[model samples]
Target: MARDRLHEMRGRVAIVGAAESDEVGRLPGKSALMLHAEAAHNALADAGLGAKDVDAVLSTGRQTANDVPEYLGIRPRYLDNTQMGGCSFIAHLQHALCIVEAGVAEVVLITHGESGASRVGMGGGDRFAPDTPPGQFEMPFGIGGPPTRYALAQARHMHEYGTTREQVAEVAVSTRKWAQRNPRALMRDPITVDDVLSSRAIAWPIHLLDCCVVTDGGGALVVTSADRAKDLRRKPVWVLGTGEATCHSIISQMPRFHVWDAAVMAGERAWAMSGAKPSDVDLAMLYDAFTIVPILALEALGFCKPGEGGAFVANGRTAPGGALPMNTNGGGLSYTHTGMYGMFLLVEAVRQLRGECGERQVAGAKTAVCHGTGGILSASATAILSTER
Candidate 1:
């Protein structure tokens, strides 16, 4: 698409409501679908609306798109079940923009619910069949799960960029400081770089502290035209820009180990569409599936030069009261990671823009950049949100 056309779509749609399920982290009682319903109801109630007002619905996970509306009692005109992994919710926001603008849907609700920890109501399937790419190409070689896959990227980054273990540990240490101030954070205890470095190693250079917390939770958002958002219950967080990109699906097939090319592409498009630079952002909600993930994101998203992400995040640069406040909901590292965490990123960004985050709020924050990664560095989505038009 032309640059002018992309720019024209900025702020055409807005998020009027954003919310999480009644409770997050270790909810053994609530099934996956129940979490979805709870979050949908909470989001709609937050928007001062109801199921009857919704004309569209989007969701991911084991449940089908139709299952979401069926459970919520919302017979929608449109439904989307685009599952790209953790970043799916951010991509859904981008799609909702087009749906509302094209008159295909007036009110769209994008939801995410996962029983990642409890495994309640989750279906079982052969993730890697013998004929599948992972099973055929990667799994036979003893490539297990995310920890091992992400460790390869981290090891290469360290080898190439001279990124030190301490620098990577700083990401966890600094993010923990932010989590300490968040009441909703699951692991809010203060942690130092030394603590992170000393934690049990999950994979080489990736400690237990570096990985995101495994929790059960759900979140939802209500998207509509900016005009309609004006009369909503909460202040509208405008969708200034949106972008999505995908690289290789399997970890071994990533374009480059040192840099996230997908994030670079997605961020550039978002920056162009929003007409905003890194300096204009008041806060950033970068997906932190692992400590190294946000370090790579900083460089790819233009917050810093390539190979300088490690140094940039060192010494409390992204912590509370720092120059750049990131992952204010304590991130997936300390907050909650219910399989796909992208929805929580949007929920926190919307709340921060609305000044609803009492303790960890970035004072006078107007613009936020929410970026999410799906799969094993396979997909990326960037969304620029602001309180302004």
Candidate 2:
């Protein structure tokens, strides 16, 4: 089947189980592989299944399909290793839906783990060779890291849209409000815009609070055919639609700084596939690797117009009491960011749809939209989930 034709997948597959590894804030003793195994076990338990029940496996990061299967002691007929950074998990979920709907896998386990805080065995180096464009041109000037590259876009957004520093800081302040209700959140203290502005600045517009917290953690999901999910342990969170796209690998190659073209394309496809408009969405789990990301995503996802994201989030619309509740689980900014945050986004969305979030739940939420950005806003993926059949 063609990848673009995901609308046919609606109500065909559902997420039956989801879980995170041990406490997210810190785990100095745990290796990345250990975290992955823990999450996989937890998710299987949540689904009332054992490793033997899983006939397929999907994962990202340094771990290959073979690595995960070997560590977990399960042999699967199908395996997927689609790693595109933070949004890799989102893409994996999308692929798993197709795999299951095609009758290739009865039950699939998608997992993610990163010892970002400990950095124990976390390999790092330029993805490109020394003589490549990034190595020869961009890296030579010392403008390599994510903060520097994202700052260029944030600065441009501020200039083009007259977006203020306080408007950007509002994202942090609002997300922290949700974090206060989550016991597992790393940073739950209440923060005002003034507090965010006063915090140390990482880049010009990106402050310490504006950036996502890096911790050691892992998360996993159990997906199966809708027919099979109904017989499983937990309520089904249907995969209504999914879309993914890659714009560029290097920041310099991006078409526009103010707008993420890939996000726009991906979101539009997801919305179309789900037959859902922005108004139909009850909640959002947009990847907040940085405050600016959700801002751009809100626009690209059609929640608001271009250049209007600053105002859309300024008045607390994304806060707990707002019309459109977003990142109800503190999000990457305040919750936990273990490098690739896409898996957590789906986990929170599933919980929200299940009405499991005691304090931060969007009352009567039936539909959710989870969006993820990978590699300096280069790769984008969007998933629409609902509790409806």
Highest-scoring model, TM-score: 1
- Evaluated at residue 388, the lDDT of candidate 2 is 93
- The lDDT of each candidate is 0.92, 0.90
What residue pairs are clashing in model 2?
Answer: none
Local accuracy of candidate 1 as per-residue lDDT tens digits, 208-259? 9989999999999999997788788788899999999998899989999999
Tell me the spans in candidate 2 whose CA falls farther than 4 Å from its real position: 1-3, 123-129
| Deviation (Å) of 204 in candidate 1 | 0.5
Q: What is the lDDT of candidate 2?
A: 0.90
Stretches of candidate 1 off by over 4 Å are: 1-4
